[model samples]
Target: MRFTDLISYQALLEPSKPAIVAGGKIVTFGMLEHAVRSLSGRIHALGLQPGSLVGLSIEVPSRHVALSLALARCGLVSVPYASAATLSQLPPLALGLSDGGLVVGSAAINLVVTDEWFAPSEQPVPDVAIADDADCRVFMSSGTTGTPKPIFQSFGGMDAQAQVVANHHLLAGRVSRILCAMPLKSAWGYRSTIAALANGIAVYFAAGTADIPMTLAAYGCEYLICSVYQLQELVRLQSETMIPLPSLAAVCTGGSLVPAELVRSAQSLLCSRIILIYGSSEVGHSALEVAGMHPWQDGATGFVTPWTEMEAIAEDGRVLPRGETGELRVRSFAQARFGGQPAPDGELPWFYPGDRGSISPDGRLTISGRTVDILNIGGTKLSSERIEHALKRHPMVIDAGVMGVADRQGLTEVRAAVTVRGAVAEAELRSFVATSFPVAAPQMIKIVAAIPRGDTGKILREELRALLN
Candidate 1:
């Protein structure tokens, strides 16, 4: 049931198979296994034992992955920060190590190690066996609305997700290599990488959208995964260069609302089809839509995946019938525990992703908006999603977000930020929204270069609000 066991099995079966491709280098399974063991020994020398929480801030995708496996090999818990900046915001780690050799500690211990810290060591590190229920990884929330919460995943949960992904059949045997267009620290990126490795598929970590063409041309990749933002960038790049990735079979995207136009563009230019996934870090792979096979629905995210059970529950805890819009609750075998509290046996708790959506009789899910995204304007509770939708209806507006700002008089003011494909006047956008809801028209509309989003494509409302302020 160990995560490393999967790699070990792959190494034994196909030692020379390429596992990771990054920065013009290919790392085989044999090399990956050796690096994991070497890094595990280094971690052990740092006085970190099994179950100890280690802060990982590696920038290199290969090293980040290697360190993650090393931590799992030693049965230590890993808390990966998206960047070093994020690492500094949290409670300072007791000790830290990087390629730069900067070592800092709280009270006494501080030692600097050079690039030798990354050198492989044959020294055997004690294998601290991990229990199935023990927490092995903690994922930080995207912090779109507030402070990021720690979402904990047990060893069993991780293994279950890998198996679920392996059996999902979307990339089963069709995908030999995948290009990751998102940061490895993100839940989506990490899950995709692990699933690919678990299936013995090679992963290419593209530096950015600029590197996508080169990577695809040099090394053929069948699958691509990224957030909506990265997908947009890729499409933009392709449109400008007029280069098509004929080797790419499918592109899977998540993290924000996928516009029908973007999906169509991606299908025509980037790949043959687009797979839009709908889920949160708490509930993995709740639903997905294969765009090539299905017609696009205005607000539909997709059909529920095989391994997920979803329901729309009213505020009173009543489960609504299908086709009724309410708060979405998802129950998946691969669901993670928040705040480190496991649900009681025989009563697996349903995960509330804060999305207000409905399930059709045929199992299609359409999300109207998020419960937290509702705005209290004057005396009425207005759906910001509705306003954003109105703005996006304009031919020039590509994306929009609305937020309520409170003044000293306890009055709420509606403000909007929008990204446009062409020049769009704020008055025109405001007038367009006024045509929909004249009374709840936005007080102010500002055109921006881009919408603030996390790696997964979720809007960073906190940052958006900051910009509005």
Candidate 2:
């Protein structure tokens, strides 16, 4: 079934049920259907055809959600661009990644739409038939390396992925209300919000990061979808003020490696189960870990999800046996599209995620680090994830990033940058890391205000390297 059809079905089943809560206004399913239909009629009047690429730069969560569903119902591929990006920055990125047929938003861009376009209309919205395999949405990558690339997915794939995420997070019938703390344009944010909506759950969008805890408490949300960094901030806030989220039961965190210490601290203060998810934009979710259900070990990502096939391969292209570390590869029925086409280059059956990891005989997946982030010091290879994990163990450290830097002699040494909650001596921090992991101690450590990160919380290694220069 098309993802848009799910909204109509929900409206039919529970029209009066709350579908979205944004900007202190509640929109019921009935109102959502009407708004989508009204906006869709306006879009159709513009003469845009099926499969046409429509760019969306709306910042309001309610409007973004409605317009996305409307674009899908009209059989148009909706590409949600970064709301904070400039018009000049968007066109080139959209042209290189998507078909770039039209742009729609409050910005003064080409084919711009005004407030009147989304005003309530009396015209009946026509039902546009859409093929199951037709591309329905284009999501931009986090753009950590360079320009963000457009990732496409079919209607059927999106529906299937939404179901998988909903089922995995227990959002179907158990969760009545959820708060999304990430940007609506992010893959995780968009997918998790739609998944909740598809399962007949109400979603609350926070005004900003600082307001997440208050939003959750005000809305009495039962679940929260946030990045690891956001979770860390929430934990810090809760610890300082002892704020109570009376209804919050589960907190799902992903987009980067979550420190075990952070998870333990959050679980203690919030009294909520911490679910760590490991996956990428290319693959929806490959592994999941629930607090107290499994032992949190270095690089452990918990059990692999049932929908995807995961394996570890050695340098010689040989699939390694369980308990051995190697490059992680995944094969799933719901793979993402690049430039409106399937990704991973070549005709290989499996998609290499470029993550170094290992799978246990019991089926638990442990992600060691990214292939590109591995550091070679005097021919001794070390995983950057391990060093970062060690640095994070310090009580004063809030976040840490480790990378290789070459010196005058072209010899690589491990350098670390960290964000701390309080004043801490660099020598003391380095000494702590050395004691924690003597074999992989960093040669130098710099205390910074914050580590540069992408939207999804992945460290920008190039940006961190620039600090050293």
Candidate 3:
């Protein structure tokens, strides 16, 4: 079902229910639907084309959901942008989104074709959402070099994915409150904004990653669907019992493998179980831990929804046995993408988004790692995640980062940097790492107060590379 349909459903069935709570204000489903419909009229009144882009710059709350819904309702494409990217990055982000079309909003940057997008209501509309044969909904993803990739999305691709979320994750008759912590400019972030709304769950918006833990505590957020790094930080901060989480039910960690210790700790500390989900900006939220057992431990590691058809394929393009590990190729025509890319895989009905994972013997699923995050030591292939997971386990370490650095001789070295909770010398960490990975002892180590993180909580690899260099 399309995301817009849920608004109508909630408006009729539970119209007075809280649809959004932000900045000490609560908007009910009926009120939210009216706001969306009215805002959609305002958006359309801008004389934008049927599939042209309409930007939403709401910073405090309701930015993503309202904009996504209104644009979907009006048949105008909506492109959301995070206001926090570097100034040098904004201009390119705007130009990339505009694609020769008019731009809008003050949140991303100042308006106009050549400059950055504007903040919400802070700048004039950059471009009219005019008629466009081209795809709507431009999403920016982080490049390997730490640049943003402009991926287009069609309205159809979005709806198809929302159905999967509505069926697989959202339980019926259960009072759920979805916290929007991830920025909406990302496909995953935008989808999370609307996914709960698509299922008629009350939505709570956290200004950014900074506000998540406190905001989630304040709202008694039942379900948190956001990046794993943010969740990890939240779990870390919530290690103490003073933080109130009376209403929190499920901790949904995406963007990477949910740390098992984090899950167990959150369950003990905040009284909420971690629900681990594996997904991407391109594929939407896919395999979730199976329900039951501990709140954090899904009996199965793989997603079990009927809406999506998934296969694990090997390097040679052959489908792997269910018990083996491979790339996760999936298809869902019922869901919509940001661009008009034609149902992902077209005739084949599958999309392999460069993730490496496996389906277990018991039909459970586990995401081993991402294919894009490989590290080369000389010629040996090492999963960066494996090293990261190992490093985070150290008690004195708050965070750890590993990058492939080459020696003067040209042999690649597994270099590490760590943020510590207590005093830790480089040699001490090196000693620990040597004990752990005897074969691949890191030759270099740096003690940083905190690993530099991009807006998405990913360490800035380019910045780290600069550090190593």
* CA lDDT of each prediction against the hidden true structure: 0.76, 0.77, 0.62
What RMSD does model 2 have? 4.0
What digit string (tens of lDDT, one per residue) describes model 2 on residues 1-469? 6667787889899999999998899999988888888988877776666877666767677787988898888787777765434333433322111123334443333454555656788766868888767887777776655456666778877888898888866822278998888777777888888888887889898877678888888889888888877887788788888768888898888766667787889888875588878887777788887867876686677788888888999999899999899988886777676533254665425767678889999899887778887787767777787788788878898888898877899987888999888989988877887886665677888888889887667777778888755
lDDT of each residue in 1-469, candidate 3, tens digit only: 4557766687889889888887778878887676666655655555544654445444445534655676666666555654434223332332112324333433333333221211223222223333323345666665435666555666566666666666545532254777767666667666666667767778787766567777877877877766768866776777643577777766666666565666666677655455666655655666665334523332234553455567789888898998787877775544334233244443533556666777765556666666766666657676666676667777888887778776788877888787888887777776777675665556787887677776667677777777766
On a 0 to 100 scale, what is the lDDT of residue 201 in model 1?
85
Indicate which candidate wins on lDDT.
Answer: 2
Instruction: Provide the TM-score for each candidate, comma-separated.
Output: 0.87, 0.89, 0.79
Model 1: ten consecutive residues of lowest lDDT: 101-110
* Stretches of candidate 1 exceeding 4 Å from the true structure: 82-95, 101-115, 118-120, 169-173, 340-345, 375-400, 406-413, 419-424, 431-441, 448-450
Model 2 misplacement above 4 A: 83-114, 171-173, 339-349, 378-380
What's the TM for model 2? 0.89
- Best-to-worst order by TM-score is 2, 1, 3
